[model samples]
Target: MAHVVTAFLRNRGRILLTRRSDAVGTYSGKWAGVSGYVEGDPNDAEDDARRELEEEVGVTEATLANTAQPMHITDGEREWTVHAFMFDVNHRDIAPNEELAAVEWVHAPVICERDTVPELWPTYRRVAPTLETVQTDDAHGSAWVSLRALEVLRDAASDAESWEVLVSFGRSLRDARPSMAAVTNRVNRVLADAAGDTEALCQRAAAEIDAAAEADDVASAEAAQLLRTEGYDHVATLSRSGTVRAALEDAGPSVLVAESRPGLEGVTVAESLAKKGLETTLTTDAALPGLVADGAVDAVLVGADAVLSSGDVVNKVGSYPVALAAARADVPVFAVCARDKIRGDDTVVGEEGGALYDGDLPITVSNPLFELVPSDLADGVVTEEGRLDSDGVERVAAEHAELARWDESTSSGADAGGDG
Candidate 1:
């Protein structure tokens, strides 16, 4: 078996198809996209795709529009697992090598309609949408997670080799967005099952991640019920939590969404709630304190990126102030998070980013990823295991840690940051 890369170079709605020269070793005179054997590190498929395009058609300045999961194809006694790529090119001029007889710019729709190499259409179909999903510039939070997870699931298999591939894929996604707790939580959650029988780990991991993306499932319903029990009809939330959004949707409460600064993720949350027909109010972060002080909000319900063992929550930066205001105004603050988000007590710190404006100014802009909401300020925490008070959070955290030890015979070891 051998690995290879196929790159489709597109310009002005047409893709370049090269006819393999009769002098080529195999598939001579067949219409195919720019392709070559995996000559370097297999993981660097994009580089290989670009290299093939340059070597075959003499194009070098193309942008990678999409990359797809590898597709395994067997032709007689030989097998090839092909990595496909789609590139958007600025120019159409091509210089065919001795290995390529000629190059034709054909419309993408009619590629399969022409005489072509074996399994070309199947390879294209498998890799096309991957580019579309990954190339989406505006996907954020859970939407991004869901899209990436599908790709991960597509690559998952029930063997050691497959598990390694999945783990590598998960790690890549996690590294792409370090500030996103959901990414780490979902990745780590799936990886936890790796030590067990991997017969269905891929499917199981995909199912778990899909449920996490949906947000409005049984766990959220339970959180919603807790809100209902508390008689909260108008809830205020800063930043966005898929879990919080689900709970708000299920509870059917009017929502006050703070314009989460830096990222403005809160605006997205507010828009989503408004579209659901909820009386959603979009306000500035400064106004949240006033809203809580005026008792305009029934309670402050938020989401946690990481729920620490000490019961402190690592959430969007402005969460601390909102929780503080809620406490001062006698408004209960609850963090709607799932049990998996209870990733072991690691030191959670707010991150600083370019969202504060990248100017050549002599002033410092503070853009932290999240701030700690001390356990005392957060009156309760709602997870799949049910609602836990400040003391209950510690109890649950310790219990969950013990359970994890029994499950995996390992401990992430609690990091001391906030009080228990």
Candidate 2:
């Protein structure tokens, strides 16, 4: 069997699809991701995928997001095995070689309608997040997961037979990450605005995905401004928050990131910030709070999994101690996130994780994925709408509550139709 690699380049919520030139050996004039024949052992497929991306689209630098198992396809007497890879790129500029007739960055669902090579949609599905992926994801923050949930709905809506089925899909996405208020709030907004229409729902889901991304951008900008205006030269954070990274990039603050245990997401964050030319320091989770108490940190900025109506922030485990240390040091602690993360209630749902310790000793090991930092511990909350006061948080929470009512409204409509 012949082995080949296909790399999907993603930027700003779209995938790059290239139209193969007629001069290519096979699948000429068909839309496909950056692809090429794999050289050497299949175990080294990722290197071949990167090499193809550089040759096909002039993309020399990109973060590998995912890889799928090899898919076998039979075209005539030739058997071919396709290896799929996905990359998240920072820029959209592309220099298409002669092998590509044209290139366009489009939503993944659009691939379904396009005349493409064999199993292109299936290959994309392998890299994209499913409901299960969203639920089990530990690498990304809630804001990131919420946007991915919208993408999941967008793809599902394309195949849904009726409005009822679409609603069911949206409901499943809304409940996929219970601790992620942004996931529930954003999905609810799309469902409520669509109002039981499939086409409208699809359109709204796409629009909301863009809006949600923009919201994070705006919130990051707001936080950056806060950092500059307040003269917070040194900031400390825990875990990996995309918005937090963006804000630090914009503000150019010296950063100390705690190595969020088990996952060590903060190591990734610290490396990313350092690459962006920011002064960065990596510390163990246990050392971070002490560093804050030593006045090494001017401010503590974190991304929220949920901002409760009571103004408390639910974030990755180990945030509370940092907040407490910041409070003791009189350093301002800010929770940064889009307004969609604000929940209508103060109830915090905790996710239990698998035991980290496996031994013959019968001691229980508790691994909670999240924890709550009381509202009093936070100095302020920064959002796209600016610094939100307690009243503003409550107002956003009320809006969220109203958006959540779409479920009741849809269910009632279905019951009324049955009665009719």
Which candidate leads in lDDT?
A: 2
Give the number of the best model, judged by TM-score. 2
lDDT of 2 by residue, 1-420 (tens): 999998999876778999999879998989999999999789899999999998988999999888989999886888889999999997899999999999998888889889898889988888877888788888788988898899888878877899888888788889999999999998999899988778788788888888998999999999999999999999999998899899999999999999998888888999999999999999999999999999998999999999999999999889999999999999999999999999988889989877887889888888899999999999889999999999999999999999999999889989999999
- What is the Cα-based TM-score of model 1? 0.59
For candidate 2, give the lDDT of residue 2: 94
Model 2 weakest 10-residue run by lDDT? 195-204
| TM-scores for the candidates | 0.59, 0.94
State how far residue 107 of model 1 sits from its true place (Å).
31
Q: List the residue pairs that clash in candidate 1.
A: 66-131, 351-368, 351-369
Candidate 2 residues lying further than 4 Å off, grouped into runs, are: 74-79, 360-364, 418-420
